[model samples]
Target: MDINLEMINLIKGEFDIHVLIELPQTMLHANIFDLNANLNEYDSLTSFWPVAGKWQLEYLEEYFSGCESVHFVIYKPGSKLDLIKTTYKVLKFINKHKFDYLQFDDFSARQAFLLPFLKLNKRLILSIHDPIPHGGEFEWKRSVIKKMFYGKAKAFITYSSFSKDLLRKTLGLDKQVVNLNLLPYTVFRKFLTHHTVEQERGYISFVGRLSQYKGIDLFIEALPTILKEFPDQKFMIAGRPAFGYAVDSSKLANMASSVSVMERHLSNQEIVDVISKSKLIVCPYLEATQSGVVMTAYALGCPVLVTNTGGLAESVLDNYTGMVAKAISSDAIAAKILDFLKLNLYQDMHAHITGDQLVSKLSSSNLETLSQIYI
Candidate 1:
């Protein structure tokens, strides 16, 4: 149950913050929180597993004791009773400690479930991370503002300008909303290790879920044309497949030998390694809300070739950091890849955003802004 002192110190040193709330172990790798873990054999679906809960509670209590202000970041949906109970237990403990801020990631669900406790605390920050508009006219923004109105929190935070615009234009709540984009810390470090820039590795790498919307099938379909031009070029596919959208890897491999698929969950370190070694990271998503992968790729100085859909466009400046292909089309993806290969600007772009530069840009200052919202 012991907390990592080094990690705590690192966070404190970077942000000049005393305490941060850590959720119980349940939410860390919980099946409900992450759909990618559903198919894994090691995933435990049962709620309130005695050992994990006990250890997590003990660890979190110790961690909270050391910090000045503990901000709890909750990301679970409202359906699970066990999650609710666990959250309540944490909240009660935080109440006793008189923590500085209580932050909830899902505005509506958190407001609904934690309304009783949150109503008493005027320091609560109800936040949302809706990357794409839910229905038409950014229904998610309206829903969030409604939640904020009901919850009566100190402030609200969101991730993108699209959502921020919807909040301002549709809801007329611009002053109440804050936009803090995702930081690519992992990718930034990889770029620093290489002393001399080598020739482009010349492979298309896709690092995310293998679901239908992820455009894995599109990448598979385009393999024939891609391989025809560069027979020796390889295609690396990392990350576990999403729930309910499974793929037959054996059949997929037989169809395209050039396509090297790592059909397993990769650790954060492994992800950085794969991205750093690649020529380009292909995010061929048919539809995306917000992209963590795009930011990760840019952080690693690995140019991205993404589709012109959703937040992918927002993340990758087309023909700048990377190219944007037509959505849901393999031919378009292949064309973009071909176009990218033809260009000789990889090193120039890589030099522009060094690891230290990215780290400084996405450093403690960003987290400080987030802290302001919570405080």
Candidate 2:
């Protein structure tokens, strides 16, 4: 669901982009994405699966198609023997092809092995959305290892200047960094128009995966104070847990009686419906680079109340596009929510962040900047 449909639309015409994904052989159980849907725009699609044994391979051959080259490389999940095999297979594949450029959206332990293949660093473009680590030294050490291991890339791209600056200051990256400012994610535009009922409008929402760094806990903690002001107001927490984090549904019981919890991963249509039903989307992140949730809110013309950390504040124009918290504390978040409601800022913001406005802003400028990387 994080696939930027807007970015896909922008680059599909000019770029022959291939998608490399790690998935099970049969996508029947895949919840995060549908490999077959909306893939006609891609040049090729390759999946790395765990034990693509004889039967699984046959199932993949039959179930998956439309990709120019439907290929699979086997890698057993959570097993050292298979990880080594997968690494070697992936390295061999990389060695065989010569790409014009490579853009890394993330750099983690899973990708650490591929860093050494960066002999031609100039053809590599590092896209660091969250440049600084959430924790202290451990993350910093990992980042340094990544930078030194990969060496310097030809260029860097980020969603906001705040993240780009963080990359420069924290990682000492001096490459040509470009900010593809505020690209609209209209993946659910049609869905919103169809499924969103006008009568369902008006609840304060926290949309996206519930992670500690995302500060959904802070938003939950702030709910008591928020409800004191608007007794009839309902607060909806709509999203599943992020990777290793579990959102304890039991805690919702102890909280205010009006808090609605949608603790499952929502589809694109469901996400649009939740966002559309809300008067304001709140992101109480303790740290962030850029928020796709905020962008999604903007795309739907829904105003946001975000914490003033990292690029969250930068994403909003403060009182114009959205409101930012005074601080990251529970008290600060509650105060901002109440204050935002008092001012009645949604109508003004909704008028400003229109689909046409985002399209105009996302057009030639972003396209030119991204096209330059290919050049």
Candidate 3:
């Protein structure tokens, strides 16, 4: 999304920090010429190109002109033309205005390649998001550190402490590592509101990318046992398969007669609606780092049942915000779900922990920490 004036105002007013966000397209088309002067032509195939280019250029100009401590959050990597253009634009801007820092979220991408171009600017933040399981223990870490060292990153940011620990202890780069939690504001504003009270629903919900590691099969396996005790209970699984992962719809369908599966990407509002409407949100992940889904459940005041893997427990206090099951076992997940069902603590806990209060606390902490870094 383009950084609007409202977002600019919010950053300036709330945190007293001036941010100049380089538009994505300006970086994308950095060196590509208007090859045919057909940049304005609405060709069915390439119509999106020029429009995106113009939009990004406009946003970049406005942002660079307005703010002093300019920061560019690069979303794409290794588009040579884009990288060259971005490097040129940034160099010119830095020479003209003296930018304090150039930050990148995906450090492994073009950031590494573009570092030599910006070697004059000593301030660079190279971040990484390890969203999947890395099987090799020490060897994988050594390689990651080697990459970071080559990248010349001043600061390194990651989503979880597990990965951070790999960078810190194994690579001995603790001084450079920073932990930045993912925000769930999109889900919060979409599904959660103070006005909505608890509603009774017969089914339990799971929303996220449907994959083997996500343990949807395990949830399916536990259904029969859960059905034995509570005959009326139903299971709802939402979200599509991860990109390039094989998804067997018939296999999922065969698991249970009462299962309701929505195999498509749900909008933020739809996700909130489903979670808010359900009795509980179940995260039966085989592995995870930190979960944006768990945070969404918490912010929506939906009681959660998560596995004791990764950073799931970090956000969920046992028997407080939600319940944590034993690691990677269907029976354990089932037991926790049954326990939460038996206790019926959904309403009481929901009333106790205010969503706005939690959101404000997280938002404030993030802003405070980020402000210190920016300054």
Candidate 4:
């Protein structure tokens, strides 16, 4: 469905909004992180840099049709000389152009190291998705360099309240902070509108690259108890594990009849295929912040059962959309999972989850907020 949502409100001011994203071959069709990729900031006008890639025109016409305001200047530079060359190209381009406001959309390796030291005259803003690296993935040098990166931005935007608060305490700045909710990844909208999965809804899944803070092992541990009651209940674990972490093939092998694991990178259509068929998505995080996975589940009209850590609990409206585990233990997770199934909450949640309003509202709110601050 190429549903072109007409925004109810246009930002009050008139300025060219330029969003910068320099990463390794990331797609506007893949995520909501490239927020401006599909959303318009101005009520009736849209503008793009002369150098905008012709390849992106298809995505714009299909998903971003009739939208106004922000235009993304995405430049992905290669290693060594190419990196230096493209860095200068981007900087020079910025100096040469006249965007009323420019925002670095997210943290990228090259941007973090080079952006702070550059001498550009334009107003700059940064949106930090992860204020700190997850528990086991931290490094001292990255932290030091990241602090310098934090110092350059004139304003900050975060999707999670937890990250906004932590960034303040960690960086000691509070003014010009904007907190907005993450929008559902709409890359799946077309697939969902056309095809429907044939499987009866019983699968409960853990999606996303398996990482230490993600608590995949805890989710596995809680499974036996859930299986004891709903003996035929299905379980699916998707996505490749991060470095130094592994999912035991043998551990899940015992319950082979009921478990399905896809340990590799998943395409956008494949993700929609799984979440759309499943009744519940699980995010058993042991630590905090926000989740894009939870947002995807909402898009598919599938409810989630998340651990009561970070922004996971805050993201789910318990008893309606989904439920949060009382504690971060296997037993607590199982208990909530059981409650959701026993009460037959899936039917009501599935019916209520059709995501059109939620998606449009998130965009509308963020655009309005940005208009106020960027002025």
Q: What's the TM-score of each model vs. the native?
A: 0.66, 0.75, 0.70, 0.81
lDDT of 1 by residue, 8-110 (tens): 4335544434343334335454211222322222211222223234333333343334355544433344336656654576556556766565555554444
How many clashing pairs does model 4 include?
3
Candidate topping TM-score: 4
Candidate 4: residue 245 lDDT (0-100): 76
Runs off by more than 4 Å, candidate 4? 1-15, 23-79, 112-122, 193-199, 355-364
Return the clash pairs for model 4, or none.
40-68, 41-69, 42-69
RMSD to truth, every model? 7.6, 6.3, 7.4, 6.1
Candidate 3 on 1-375: residue-level lDDT in tens?
A: 221332243345444333433334334332111112332232212222234455433333332243434444333333566556555655555456555665554533333444555654447765555534432223455456456543465666666677666566544443467665554423244344443445555569888776667777777777777777877787788886663444456655655567788887675456766777776888888777767677666656677788887766666768877889876788998888888778877776676444566556655665665665566
Between candidates 2 and 4, the one scoring higher on TM-score is 4
Q: Report the alpha-carbon TM-score of model 2 versus the true structure.
A: 0.75
Per model, state how many residue pairs clash: 2, 0, 0, 3
Best by lDDT: 2
Residue 122's lDDT within candidate 3 is 47
| Candidate 3 lDDT score at position 27 | 40
Candidate 1 lDDT (Cα, 0 to 1): 0.58
